[model samples]
Target: MIPPATPSPSAPKPSRQRQIGGLEFILLMGLLQALQALAVDSMLPALGTMAVDLGARDPNQRQLVVGIFLICSGLGCLLPGTLADRYGRRPVLITCLTSYILCSTACALVTNFDQLLVLRAILGVACAGLMVLPAAIIRDRHEGDAMARLQSTVGIVFMVVPMIAPSVGQAVLLVASWRWIFGVMALLGSLILFWMATRLPETLRPEFKQPIAPRKLAMTMGAIITTRSAAGYVLGMALIQGAMFGYINSSQQLVAEHFGAGARFPLIFAGMAACMACSNFTNSRIVEKFGARRVSHTALLIYIGTSALQFYIASQPNETLWEFVPMMTVNMCLLGFLGSNFTSIALQPFARSAGAAASAQSFIRMVLASCLGSMVGQAFDGTARPLAFALMVAGLGCLVLVLFSEKGRLFRRLLPPGTPRPIA
Candidate 1:
C-alpha cells in the first residue's frame, strides 16, 4: 500500500486559522470548479450559431473553440500549482479569477472566429488555476476515502452547472446575441470570486512551502511520475476522461444534426447530465462505506462493459436514438463514480506536495484528454461509431493502467492506520 509522505521537517510550521464551514467549503469549491464547466457546456448550444456568425466555413472547425480552450487550459495548469506552493493558494487563485473574468468579457466582444478562438485560449489558461487549486485545498484537509467523499460531494454540486448549462446558452440565444453567453460567464465568475475572497481562508500548511528551485521541482515531478499508484490512476483517469471529452466535443453534432434532436438538444443533453449528478450524489453517500478502491474499481469494469455495448449497437445498421442514449447515459453515470475516487487514490501519496502533485497530474490529464478528445471530435462521421469505439478503447486502456498500478491487484482497500476518516 502506498502511504502519503509526511510534512517536511525542515520547513517551519505556522499556526492554523479559522477554516470555512464544511457545507460552505463544499459549495464554494464546487462552484469554483463549475466555472470551468459552465464556460464549456454553455457554449454547446450556441456552437452552430457562432460558427455561422464567425464565418466558420466548416462545421468541425467550430469545435476548435472548445478544443483549443481545453488544450490551453492543460498547458496553463503547468505553472499555477508550483507558484501556489511557493507563494500561497489564495492570492494566486485571486489573480486567476481576475484574468478569467477579463478574458470572458473579451470573448463577448470578439468580432471574428479567429479573434474569439484567441480569447477562448486565454480564458482556458486563466481557468486552469480554478481546476488545480481546489484539489490542493481539499487535500490540505482530507486524504484517502474521506477526501474521495468530499470530492464526490463537490462533484454533485459541480454537476448541476452542466445539467443546465446548455439550456442557459439556449435561453441567452432566444433573448439576445450569442455573445451574451460570455457576458453571463463573466457575471457568474465575478460572484464566485467575491464569495471566495470574502470567505475562503488559506489551506496550504506552512511546512509544505518549500523553495521553487529547479532541482526541487525536478524531484517533485520525478516522484509523481515514478510512484506506481499515482502514475497509474493519473493516466487511467485521463484515458476515460478523454473518452468523455470526445462525447462533449461531438454531442452537439451527433445529437442535434444526426439524431434529429435539433430543437430539443438542450433537454436531451440535460437528461444525460442529470444521470451524472445523481451518480455523484450516490457516490458521496456510499463511497465512505464501500471504499474508494472497491467502488471505483467495480465502476471501471462496468464502464468497460457499458462502452462495449454502446460500440456494438453503434456498429449495427439500424441503431436508433433510444438505443444509443441509454448506453451513453450509463457511461456518463459511471463517470461520476470514477472521477473523484481515481483522483483521491492517485494523490494519496503526495500530502506534502499536494499543489505540485495536483498541478502535474491535472496538466497530464487535461493535455492528453484534450488532444484525444479533439481526435475523436474530428473523427465524427455523421454516425455514433467513432464515439462508441473511442469509449470502449478508453475503458480497456484504463483497466490496463490500473493493473500496472496495482501489480494486478484490484478491489483492495489499502488505507494506512491513521488516514483521515470521512468528514461528517
Candidate 2:
C-alpha cells in the first residue's frame, strides 16, 4: 500500500477515535449530497417550462439554469472538507445545510432567470459542504474494507436517490410549477438539518482539529499533488467524471431523438440509474474481496471495453434505442463500482491531512470534471454520435491515466491467493 505523506513535526491524529456507525452516518451524508445532484437532474425535464414560463429568450439559457448550477457545485466542492476539519463536521454540516435550504427556497421564489441562476449558484456552494463533509467524516473513521463498506452503503443511498429524484420532480411539475422543486428541496434540506442536529456528532477529535491556518492548508494541498498514489487516483476520478458530465448533458437529446422516449424519458433514465444502484451494492459486497485497487482497475477495463463496443455501434447507420440503453447501462454500472473505491484509495494516504486533502482533491476533481465534461457534453451534434465518442474516448483515456499515474501497477494488490477478506 502507498504510505501517507509526511506529517508536520507537530502534526496530530485523533487520540481516542470516536466510535460510531459509519454506514448510517455516511449514508445520510450521501443522501444530503444526492439532494444536490437531484437539484440538477430533477429539473432537467422541466427546463423548457422553466424557460418559457420565465420568458427566457435564449435557447441556451434554459440549460444554464441546470448547467450553471452544476458548474457552481463543482467549484463549491473545494472548501467544506477543510472547514469541517478545522471546526467540527456536525457544525459545518449544519451551517451548510441551513445555507442550502435558504438558497433553495430562494430559487423557488425567483421570478427572473438571472435571480434563479444566482440562487442556484448559492445553493451549489452550500451543497458543496454537503458533498465534502460526509466523505471526510467517513474517512476519519474507517479504512480499507471497512471504508469500502461505508462507501458502498453510502453509495447505495446516493445511487437510489438519483433514480427517484427526477420522477418526484416530474410529479411536482404535474400540479405545481418548477419553483415548487426548490420548495421540496428546501424541505429536504431542513430534514437533513434536523437529522444532523440529532443523530450526527463531531467526528474530528480535538487533537486532529487544527486552526484553519494558511500554512497548514497550503501544506495539505501540496502533499496531495506531491503524493504519487493520491495524485493518480484523483486524476483517474476526474477522467471518469468528465465522461459523466458528457452523459448528463447528452441524455435528454439522445433519449428524445434516438429513442423517441418523449416525456416518459425520465423513466428510462431512472432505469439506468437503477443499474448504477445495483452495481454499487455489489461493489460494497466484493470490494473487500478484491481491494479498491483491484476492483477499480478491473472496472476501468470493462468500462473501456464497453465504450469501445459503443463506439463501433455509433459508427453504424442503423443504431437504435436498444443499442444506447444497454450499452449505457453497462457503462453506468462501472461508474457505480468505481466511484467509491477510487475516492477511498485517493483519500487513504492523506488521513493526517484529511480536511485539507479532501478539500483540494474534491475541488480539483470537480473543476476538472465540470469543465471537461461540459465541453464534451456540449459537443453533441444533435445525435448519440458525440455521446458515444466521449464515452469511449474518456473511458479508455481514464484507464490509461490510471496506468500512467500508478506506474502500471493495478489489480496486483488484490488479496493474495486463497486469502480471506473482511467485512464491516
Structural similarity to truth (TM-score) of each candidate = 0.86, 0.83
lDDT of 2 at 383: 63
Q: What TM-score does model 2 achieve against the real structure?
A: 0.83
Each model's lDDT: 0.86, 0.76
Clashing pairs in 2: none
lDDT of 2 by residue, 1-424 (tens): 2223222233234334433343455557678878777887888777768888888886545656766667788787766765776787888889888998898888887788888888887877887887777777666666665665565567667777778877887899889988898889889888878877777656667787766676876777688778887787788788788778777765665675557877787888899888888887788789888788888888998998988899889888878888888998999999977888888788888767665676778777887887777777667665677778888887777777677667887776744558887776
Scored by TM-score, the top model is 1
Superposition TM-score, candidate 1 onto the true structure: 0.86
Tens digits of per-residue lDDT, candidate 1, 1-424, equal: 2223233333233335434657888899999999999999999989988999989988888888899999998989877777787888889999999998999899898889999999999889888889888877777767666676677677778879888999999999999999999999999999999988877877676667757776766677788789997898999999999889988988889988888888698998999999888887788789889899999999999999999989999999968888988899999999989998998899899989775676677778889999899899989898999999999999999999999998999999887789987789
- The clash count of every prediction, one per candidate, is 0, 0
